[model samples]
Target: MKNFISVVVTLFAVSFAKAQIPAGYYDAATGLTGYSLKTKLKEIVTNGHQDKGYGGLWDAYKVGDLDKFYENDNTILDIYSEKPAGPDAYSYTPVTDQCGGTTPGSEGGCYNREHLFPQGFFSSASPMRNDYHHVMPTDNVVNGKRNNYPFGTVGTASWTSTNGSKLGVSSFPGFLGIVFEPIDEFKGDVARSLLYFITRYEDDLQTFNYSDVNNPQDGSKNRGFD
Candidate 1:
């Protein structure tokens, strides 16, 4: 019993240490926090300029020109390549027909960039906008199916995309299996992104959907679209 207890304690410590965030990963000086963060993001979308020639956040991230928060690398490609294996491995399938495609003359076959954090709610801010940590290339039709519905697990998908992605239900086994697809390498990144969003926008959290698992922190009291 004594040996077992000792091993358990050691394991717990190791897990906790692995999950700790490094200091300075999210400094405001990176020009992504406070008023500066807001100002630069506004410049990107003023006067419907974004809708004209703007290629969305993914295009901006590829060029490392998302407002002012530039990434040190092609973090999205790195994350996708390094994703985990087994049942948890990132699954890529054709999004359903309803979502459509972007490639010319291809009909609806290719995947489109997906924002794990939906663009509609954030007003498509640049800092969070082009972050590869949350952006995924998924089927465009499936994206349309998802629309702005809050994430959740269900027995059936209420809607299905052209390629096959569905918005009805999540198949994950977690307590609140709100299904989200993150590449294998970036599971930790997704978790951290959620933590950041919660902390930074703690005041507006309630406005968004809050599952027992997704938004576990309740100490702060602000809400966003749900």
Candidate 2:
């Protein structure tokens, strides 16, 4: 009985420690309750950008003009710049012609901007929309396969991107873990982006697939199980 009690206490302490958020990070305001938070997120996404071609979806992949997208994406770059490592740390140029021998317009290569936190799950708002933390260049078809599926680790992935940059797993032990390998230069940035998504969208988090009840503070929930 004494041994059991000790083990229980130890587990509780570990869980408590894991639940603590990092200092100086964003926390949902108590007053920003219910849909108010959602509204605020949307406002942040659409305020400055011209909506001429801005469809409701966060379709970075479908933007008709790359230059226009870059012009609008400046706001997102600003947000990313304020983080610990900052914007330049997370930015990268897609190998424009390097389709890995895959044909142009093919699903394999042809670089695209991918949303780490899928747009399909949320209404796709600003801050969320323009936030550079979760947005990055990736292959097209792989992005579709990922399509708002919760991140997780899988013993076997159902799909693999042509560039070998992204893949999807069938199952994981904890938190629907999705394993993402970014260019070595941006791994930290991707990790931070995931952390940011969990905290910023905590209320709507359950709306998307999640492996655990704990919020972003505990990386264990929605963590890379592998």
Candidate 3:
């Protein structure tokens, strides 16, 4: 939903790591396929869904968003600002660097919650608004620059962050809209997050507003996935 339509297609990258899904999570959908499998998954995934509210995300990030892989410095591992090959241009301590509303004038200012699926489409509704799976801590300026654009393959970048994430016109076929392209290392994270959003919120997908995307007409059933 949420102008995230293009992401459903651009999600070919392999996840950097895979978590162990709950033991019986997909057992119900085992023999299903196509829409049937999708329906079963909707039931399977949404069964125990809970909303921790918006405040809980900060606490969740403390466990889920820390830097343990690359620099191993225990700073915030921001996908939009992380430079894996060498040192990061800047880094944030978990709580100390969390931003309020004001964004820094530069790239490495402060980190804030970035909704991969965006909150605007659903009017910032519950569960979806606070879904820790899709809401991630990212640099304030880069997050602002991403500004709800659908993730896609960029042909020509209008702007690029220090880590090479881009805000650009789509190079992907069948779409010419503006898109934000995250770096290769994090593309799978973006893809998986968006897919989780779709599955988790399948019932509400039809109602999300996609008018903000380039071709408002594609906001309906197919959700700009043409």
Candidate 4:
């Protein structure tokens, strides 16, 4: 029964025609290194990545939110959950396809797209706002709590998600400010998405409003803001 249940849930998720990078998409990136390799890789992703309109994400989430263990019904497939295998972060009974709700009172209210790097940081411009790599499934209330804050280690908790995620001052190196802190399990996933943003947009990164990148802020065409 357990295996049967997992199969059913996974099928539900896979039923969506999930967008994906094309085969041989990275062929051009082969044998490349550092700046040159990264540049080609950027071209590959930027050119191949289909820009699913911002509104097309409801379908996307259904496909992506399948990792939650079947045993944990309605529990978020949250990286912040200390008990990712079972038991919910909070009292959640997932409302089917009920993502991006206008107002969620708490954890289980609904899920929404969480911009790991934050779209506002880039001024909510095109492509960047709709990039699926940066946009991910998250509990509605928890997503709201994250707001537009950057992610980093938290020292004092201003607030805590039912799953135990927290928002507070930064303890990460080279910066000090309010930051969202997810569980350790999700750190690598978040880091990769952020790196993807830098790599894929390397050609136009400097144009974005944020100064986190090491590029010149001259607003050049290759400014990396796209």
Candidate 5:
């Protein structure tokens, strides 16, 4: 069943290879690739993106994943609970303390609205803070462990998710700092997500504090996967 699900997901991605944008969306950037192609996509997507509010994400982000989320399991495709590691998955119940934890910032106190991109680097600016594209649902404890660390291979795990997502130093060359490494099963999903954030926010990146395509914290480039 897991293999079947994986195949289905792969097919879904393959289908996207032939994706079409609305009429004339990239007519100007036809045949463009690399930086130029990305530039055009940035203009196209940014132009159409709606700056939704932070409050709206709870209701909004769960659109496609609600059914997939096992409420009793206390997760939303949680990497910490997948397997080969998961035993004590942090729950995602939202009724008690929303906006995540305010203190003791190392464990899951409430459902966490994680920024795929660190908010501190961006100074919690609007659109980025409110943008659902970059933020995601995670446990407050797991989220805190991830903190502002960049994603990379964890050679020596100081912390680990039940499913094997890790928080530690970067063993994956190019980037050699503390970083978060989601489990293998979710690596592709994470990559796709971060890429979308970069592509969608390319233009506005110049105004932000850190805009490096790789290692946004230090402007050092690194491979997306280990």
Candidate 6:
């Protein structure tokens, strides 16, 4: 899963970097390295970003969240239930399978927008709450199980999803709260998504929730675990 997931993420990253970037988008950072490159990237990522509002995420999924890599059926690519090498445990149609007021008691019932950064951290503020880069369509029940927990390796899972994602106490050092661990197939995607979120919102991260004592912030603007 690590090798395959890494390849997939690398391909996606390379493709987006090469094709989606507008001409001269990185012209300012040409020949930059180290802190110079980092500063330029933050400038590039933060500028011209628009807030689409929370409702727009549902519409965005029709084009952005389809299962094009696996199953190839154009269903929602739910990380919590997707089996990359075989048929999924279940599938969801774009609009028809979206969650309403009631959430499923189990997996495969309906899908909802999951904030990879956890919306509560920022109090569900605009732009961050609606960002397509981190907000993904996922099984409602599994998303509830994830709740606001940080991602980590689980020691003993209290609950497991159909695709083997776990919700349990953390094996990661420093932090000892229950954490959600996605299957290995999606770890790269999750990591890259979080990196993008932090870079794009670097200016605002200091204002986010920071009540956890174990996870300390760097003296610089970036958040980190000590």
| Candidate 3 structure quality by residue, lDDT tens digits, 152-220 | 889989999999999999998888989999999998888678676775677777777766664222343
Report the C-alpha displacement of residue 157, candidate 5, in angstroms: 0.8
Root-mean-square deviation of every model: 12.0, 12.3, 4.3, 9.4, 6.8, 4.4
TM-score of each: 0.39, 0.41, 0.86, 0.73, 0.72, 0.86
lDDT of 3 at 68: 92
Please give the lDDT score for candidate 5.
0.61
lDDT of 6: 0.78
- Identify the runs in model 6 with alpha carbons over 4 angstroms from their true place: 1-15, 213-220, 223-226
Q: Which 10 successive residues of model 3 have the least lDDT summed?
A: 8-17
User: Ten residues in a row with the worst lDDT in model 5?
Assistant: 217-226
lDDT per model vs. reference: 0.41, 0.43, 0.78, 0.63, 0.61, 0.78
Candidate that would win on lDDT: 6
How should the candidates be ordered by TM-score, best one leading?
6, 3, 4, 5, 2, 1
How far residue 115's Cα lies from its native spot in candidate 4, in Å, is 1.0
**Model 2 agreement with the true structure over 1-226: per-residue lDDT tens digits:** 3342333233323433655834522243224533344334334433464432322323442342222233344322212122223222233233332234554454533445567776654556554655544676554555555556544444555554433344454354555555543334445445556645554454454455333332223332222211
What is the C-alpha lDDT profile of model 4 across 115-146, one tens digit per residue?
Answer: 77677667888788888777877776778888
Tens-place lDDT digits, model 1, residues 82-134 = 32332212223322221243443332344456666675655665555555434
In terms of lDDT, the poorest run of 10 residues in model 6 is: 217-226
lDDT for model 4: 0.63
